[model samples]
Target: MVEQNFTKVKEFILLGFTADLQLQRVLFLIFLIIYVFCLLGNITMIFLICADSRLHTPMYFFIGNLSFLYLWYSSLFAPKILMICITDDKSISFAGCLAQFFFAAGLDLSECYLLAAMAYDCYVAITNALLYSQAMPLRLCASLVAASYFGGFLNSTIMISKTFTLSFCDNNVIDDFFCDLPLLVKLACDVKENYQAVVCFIMASNVFTPTILILASYLFIIAAILNICSIQGHLKVFSTCGSHLTAVTLYYGSILFIYSRSSSSYALEWDKVVSVFYTVVTSVLNPLLYSLRNKDVKDALKKMLDRAKVS
Candidate 1:
């Protein structure tokens, strides 16, 4: 079989948030702050989870994984974005772009499964409190974590492989910050109908499949919560799941709006703004959502602070 030969794109110019000097500086400052906060928040979540024995349950285990994913997701793109803003060097090599896409896609897909797994954990804890530990044993929790990473790697591998197969004859300018699929596909001179179909199929499978699973898990979870007779029990169950529900809604809402729609109709500026929400804002929010909302994390942080002060 003749392997499709691609004209190696020496570099890709990433048209970041804006080209206006003042606006670019302002946006850079904003994203810099966001990047710092995202790093601190995720690190805090990880430290709290590790330091506190009280949060050794499956819920915290999944939260720890979520924090790790957000860290990777942000690290994959944010640094490049910051550098682009400061140095105004938008040139990224073909190999570099593909590498960025691989990591970003892997982390994004892993997060989707991680969110679903967290929902499932909630379902087990709320629906089967008596057997929560038995249901979500340590080994099963480890397996879930492994499955998220495996699914992510598999999805990223397929997309990256398919993407590199196409020839980039023209249109090297990517109108976004990073090497995203839609923009890369648009750049390919050999863009085929089958390639489009494959992309659509991948997006559907990666985006919708886990969404359905998470929704279904929550359905059963709500049912279980309603079945609880005591008002306190109902409140407790709702409280337990509220933070996760908020995070899911924010993360998936932006993704669905961007990916589930026709690319032709996609408003680039609006889509970029929404992308910021998911990529930057969501990363910052996850740690706050899990830590601030959960008493266990707060207590853990307090203990760590105390230990620091004592030392």
Candidate 2:
């Protein structure tokens, strides 16, 4: 098989979710509302974390970064989804597709590592109160978060460079709503197995490593909880871990389902639905997860509101 040069591939036709005019209208309205809610929710978390002195801790610091990541993460796909729903234009230029995937890859990748770091924070806070301050000092927390971003950037660069370099030859139509490595590999003119292998390797390292670390952190957390004598104390200690556990489950469950599959049996439709959950639903639910599950955020929000009412 002759390898077609990738430079000649100009654009890709994105076959969005559906073609029914009525369905498109409905989806457009639905996603528009969801996007608005997503933005508002993440932005509120960012604001509450920054403005409230009560939230000046390692947990909230990571929460703020997660909110920031969610903001840009949604930006990478929501607008395009809304646009395609509202209009007949379902095409994305080669550069546009690559750029969209690039930013998304970075955000999604960073989120994995950040969540693991957060789990470790919860473990330390619960397992050892005295050493918590020294173990997760402000500098160490900042460094961990920074390292996540840097690692994500490096991994995303490798994925984007390798995947985009493949020749997208004759089939320019992507079977999903967005440009992703798996789907892009399906369209490659040659050596798809090689592309698939490299992508799978990258995805595994980014997703599985963090996932294992998170699981390990939770094991320590559970052990600590069991050692506590009082039931109330156990519940109180476990409460802090609830929000992060839920967030990790939502983010990683969907991510692993989508990215872990081999190219030998890729299912675009199922992956598409799962992608919406992780990308759209997860972004909207993150703030709610933290605020609703944890008391600190909810109290901070209430105080903020009460102050506003007084003023």
Candidate 3:
């Protein structure tokens, strides 16, 4: 069958957060500062993990991956946002939009699985203290990390493929700050049903599936915490998982709120605000949450500082 004659839209115009000049300028400054801090923080985590011998464990390995993911995640959108703020040009090429969507979705999905895996790692360590090392062996840890990246990359490919298959005609204005899948689907002129179904499938697999896994892991973790005979033991377990739980709650909660509904019902303004939480705020908070609340990471940083002083 010949391809449907669809008007090829070469570029998309991003409406951005606001049309108000004052508000846009204020937001630009705030986000620019946040972007800088997020980048530096995640990069610092990666560097600490790589340099510290004491942090050469499965847990730290995953932490490093999360850091690297955040770096890419922030990089995927920050530059474009910065450009949009500085210039009057708000149009993005069709290819550029697809590229942004691909990397952003990939990293976001990877973070979902990686966060769940990290929670599971904590569960194992807390619940099976005696065999934590043996159970989360280096090879197994490596496999899990590899699977997280592989899973993320695979999901991104599927979503992007589905998106590209859709025919875009006429409408090229996206009512969003970035090239989100749902917004893109809304812009398509024909075969909206098929595109919607494809988007729903991807959302279910990428968002809901990982959320279920993380919730189940936390359930077991909570049960294990309750079974602890001593208050001290319970506190210890809670302390260990608290940061991970906080990060998980913020990330998954925002995601669930966003993708767990129909596109027609989506509140664009509210959605953009919430999107900032996961995309930008989360990146900034992850390192602080992990480093400040995590004993191992704190110790590693101290040791690294000491080494630097001695040298």
Candidate 4:
């Protein structure tokens, strides 16, 4: 019975941006460049954090996992997008597309919780500076990261199982670049309240839960900052958290607009454009936000570069 479900569609055709040869070639080059840059930025951040003893902290630890997630997250869709651009072949087998989405979703979802965890780390580091080390102990940090991955795993599992169980009785051509959930849901022959319930639950788990936690943590951090007498203290607090705040705004804002609503309300064109930021551009921005913005990371990277020059 399960085999029948799996065999219902041997493959799916992805109706990507366009079919024009000239445009396709242009897009290929564009995506290739972005992919290369994103990989370089993320990999460099990971290299810097790992190589430098100074970065061996809970904050850098989470950032390392985030860089790894960024690498895989972009890899899931960027390669497919570039391949379609180069070959103009958008056909992907059921297992291949599902696998791509599953892993990608896991990483994306993990990033959300991970960001929230990072925010909590910031709050502790700033608001509770005296006990920051003890409060967010090494063991606790590792556990939080593990929990983020587990949460993402559950999210991806529910989404994939629920979505694929739907009857794709007709056309299998997904009208977007990648196997997006809303776009895929639109292909279903039937959608019930149960489906919406599942989606809402998934949204709450991945989006609202994390957003609320981040906001709550920041609220306390803000209170802590407001209590400071000197302006320098305020600036310090904001500098410590500004990059994370920017990243949270970018990621959660777009996602809330796109996924928090019902699937029936999805605007395919708008969704496609918005998804590019979180799916592709975020991978590029994360390293910059989490690492490049930090003085420590910049100094470490410069030192490494000069050492390489000498060696």
Clashing pairs in 3: none
Write down the TM-score for model 2: 0.94
List CA RMSD, all candidates.
Answer: 1.5, 2.1, 1.9, 2.1
> On a 0 to 100 scale, what is the lDDT of residue 115 in model 1?
87
Q: lDDT scores for all predictions?
A: 0.86, 0.86, 0.83, 0.84
Tell me, by TM-score, which candidate is best: 1
Where in model 4 is the C-alpha error above 4 Å?
A: 1-7, 260-267
Q: Write the per-residue lDDT of candidate 2 for residues 138-256, one digit (tens) a residue.
A: 99999999999999989999999887777767788887788887778777877557776887789888988998999999999888887899989888786878888888878767877
1-311 per-residue lDDT for model 1 (tens digits): 87676766778998888878888888889999999999999998998888788988899888898898898888887888888787768889989998998988888888888888998899899988888889999999999999989998898899888888888886789888888887787778787888778867886788787899899999998788778899999888977899999999998889888876676755478888887788778899999888778788888898999999999
Candidate 2, 259: how far from true, in Å? 2.8
For model 1, the run of ten residues with the poorest summed lDDT: 259-268
Q: What does candidate 4's lDDT look like per residue over 1-311, in tens digits?
A: 34334336678898878889999899899889889989999999999989999999888888898888889889888989898888957899878878887887888788889999999999998988777778888899999999999999888999888778777776788877788777777776776789879876886767778888999999999889889999999888987888889988898788877776666666467777787778898889888887666889989989999999999
Q: Where's the lowest-lDDT run of ten residues in candidate 3?
A: 190-199
Model 3, residue 292: displacement in angstroms? Answer: 1.1
Candidate 2 has an lDDT of 0.86
TM-score against truth, every candidate: 0.95, 0.94, 0.93, 0.93
Model 4 TM: 0.93
- How high is the lDDT of residue 199 in model 2? 77
